[model samples]
Target: MPARLPYAYKYLRAKKKFPHVWCPGCGIGIVMGSIIRAIDSLGWDLDDILMVSGIGCTSRMPVYVDFNTLHTTHGRALAFGTGAKMANPKLKVLAVMGDGDSMAIGGNHIIHASRRNMDITAIIVNNNNYGMTGGQFSPTTPQGAKTSTTPYGMIEPDFDICKLTEAAGANFVARGDVYHVIELDGMIKKALSGSGFRVVEALAPCPTNFGRANRQGDAVNMMELLKDNTINIAQASKLSKEKTEGKTVRGIFVDRDEIGYLERYEELCDRVLSEVKK
Candidate 1:
């Protein structure tokens, strides 16, 4: 008989959901495993966690996990997650989104969430295209890349999600790649443990769509490219700008304590109640 699955396997839904719908060589499955590993390492009870997602290939992750899951509308996962966080401050809310789902249509919501410093975690799996609907160029699609919407080549510059989140006042912000599962797992764990708004941008590959359209080879080739094009933040600091040009810098960009939205709201309520008593 084959060896049993790891303890984390218990967290998955029934065996019927086994063999996920993701295409062969897609990095989404790897990212999902990293999330499960992160949650397991933290030792948090499943009941205390809520997995939320919007409509996209990556957003489908919540359906496979056995946590309190919410599959919200397109580009509205963070909005729903914010409401859930406010309703129960103690709940550990995690919003999983695709590059298009979070950075394109939901851009406003994500930035506002960061500005508010709400205690919630968002994991953005950036595959550079709208993998679910079609191979359409997303906000994070690199310049000069080809997609269904950009057959001539993408002219718009990509948004650096980690920097965007950091600038918006997120308490924790980091970047990781599917090619580096160990590091990705660590970043997720750290994000989960953090307070206030946290965002972990995971660079993944849409082999079926983006890869084929761009002629980026197969999934393995795409992953190798990701590994080659990335540098850790610490190492990047020592390199000259010219040397690091066009490379993805992966690592924690921001981590600091701040008063979260829920705490501030509760404090305000308490103060008002005391003034009324006076």
Candidate 2:
């Protein structure tokens, strides 16, 4: 039998209530495990953490974790998380969303949230399809990939989530696939520990939806693809875009420390209060 982890490791307040509703062989479990472990490593109290999720398979993550959670409507997690952070700046706000939920319907909110640099962490689980409603094509689906909506093949290009977040002024940005569970966990911990808007885009496998439809092979094969196709950020910089064709650039893409939106607001509030007292 496998050795069990210590109480602090697996004895999170919500463990017994979890093992969640996600399907077997789904990558969401791996992502959730990493996030939960990272939260444990941070030694953050469940009461101090708030998990906000939008509609989708990945959105169900907040439901399992024993945090103060909000299961919001589709594409609204960013807005809700932003409001929550603005209201209680001390709270550790995490918005969990899926590719279709974040990049498609929620795309506008994501760009603006990064622009605002709110004190919130956005965890985007990119499975490259509309996994819940159906295996429809999504904004992150690779070019020429087939989906229920795209019987032939997807012709549109996929979104480079990390690049987009960084370009939009997110203070911290990172990318890791489900295949790199430990790496993904570390990245999540880093994002949570950082101030300001941080985005971690996790490339996960949707075997039931994306994989079966695209003939993308089994779960293990999908993970192997993650291992084979991903190149480190440093190596990616050395290669031309064409030279690194078909490669997914992994690792910490960007991390720049700056005052988060809430911190700035507090400073302004202090100034106003002092002036009023004067």
Candidate 3:
């Protein structure tokens, strides 16, 4: 059936059984497809992979994939992933989180984990507002944007995810929206192959809740917003915030070659062994 679906389609099949819980036209599916394709491209063992997620609509991703996943509490996926990596040291841990999950409640863990440069890949689905939580204004929601919590218009500032992660010491940081499917796939693949802490913030859409609440309408309209409102780093640098208007910065923002957290720990262990032997 369907020509046995190629070996490269391993991760894509899960969508069939799970169907799509996200609203039609929502970009979470697109982002998920890109992630699976990336994993397939890397030829990583499904058995050796662990997909951990925190609370939210995006966090539900790990459940649909056919990998060992831990759907943990809100904002705790990174911590759990860190422990898992430290224990096994062989498992390829991927933490799937939401904007609020990683930037708000879990912000501390994110920065500390980045500082430690753990051998883990973190994929953050940033749909601006909290889709699962009644379209509330999240840490990344643009200033003056309407949300459940800020119906009159938000007055607070937003966190540029890429810059924040890079400054916090993440070895690798990248940003890709659902609109850029190929780029998303490549970034995810690179992050997984990387040695130290990696973060990929995927700008997704919440057409049903956030879209309607913010007057952005259905999924198609939301996608159009992404197309019109996102900017690349090169483009962003040339333009001022006023010129960018409603646009956001997209694309890979940082990448560093450094010793992974576990690798360094192993080195420490080896040194202890050598000293004892002497």
Candidate 4:
């Protein structure tokens, strides 16, 4: 038998939850494993963590994890996560969303959440297209990339999720791909260990739809592409522009110290009570 991972089993549902609905070689499972390992490495209590997700392939994460899970409507993961964080203030809300779920219909929600510095972690698994909904082009689909809806080729530029979240005032922002499991785990763990609106964009491969549409070959081909095309932030800094051109840069982009939404809310409440008593 393969060596058992106690940490993984401690937080994940039993083997009865097997036969997940993702494609045979989909990278969402890698992302999920990274998440599970991150949570385990952090030694966090399962009761204190609230894993929330919107409708999509990545959204199915909550169904498998043994946490306080909320499988919400499409494009509303961050919205619901914000409310949950506000209501309890103690729960560690981790919103797992797809690119389409985060940037397409729910674009404004992430922006406002970061603006408010909400103490929640957004794990965005970006597969370039809508995997579950027939491989529609998402906001993160690369310009000139092909998708089910973009048969001729996508005409618009993709949103650099790290830059967008960083500019929007998230205390932590980072990018990781499924091919680099260790870095992805570190990014997620570091994001979870902090306050403010943290965001980790995990670029994964949607082999079934995205690959077939774009002629990206099989799962191995896509994963190999990720390995060859991505460069770490540290490594990228030392390389010249010509050397780094067209590479998908990965690593922690922003990690700033800022007070979270709940902290501000608590302060306001305390101040109001003090004024009333006085």
Ten residues in sequence with the least summed lDDT for candidate 3: 8-17
Q: Please write out the lDDT profile of model 1 over residues 1-278, one tens digit for every residue.
A: 44887786778998688778798988888888998999998998999999999999999999899999999999999899999989888889999999999999999999999999988999999999999887899999989999999989999999989889999999999999999899999999999997899999999889899999989899889999999999999999999999999898999989989988888999999999999999
Candidate 2 local distance difference test against the native: 0.88
Task: List lDDT for all candidates, in order.
Answer: 0.92, 0.88, 0.86, 0.92
Q: Stretches of candidate 2 above 4 Å error? A: 1-19, 235-243
- lDDT of model 4 at position 112: 91
Evaluation by lDDT, superior candidate among 1 and 2: 1
RMSD of 4: 1.5
Tell me the lDDT of candidate 4: 0.92
Could you tell which candidate, 2 or 4, scores higher by TM-score? 4
Clashes of 3: 0
Instruction: Give the TM-score of each candidate.
Output: 0.96, 0.92, 0.92, 0.97
Model 2 agreement with the true structure over 64-172: per-residue lDDT tens digits: 6678899999999999999988888778999999999998899999999999898889999999999888799989988899999989999999998888999999999
In model 1, residue pairs whose N, Cα or C atoms come closer than 3 Å (at least 3 residues apart or on different chains), thus clashing, are none
Which residue runs of candidate 3 sit more than 4 Å off their true CA positions?
6-9, 12-17, 234-246
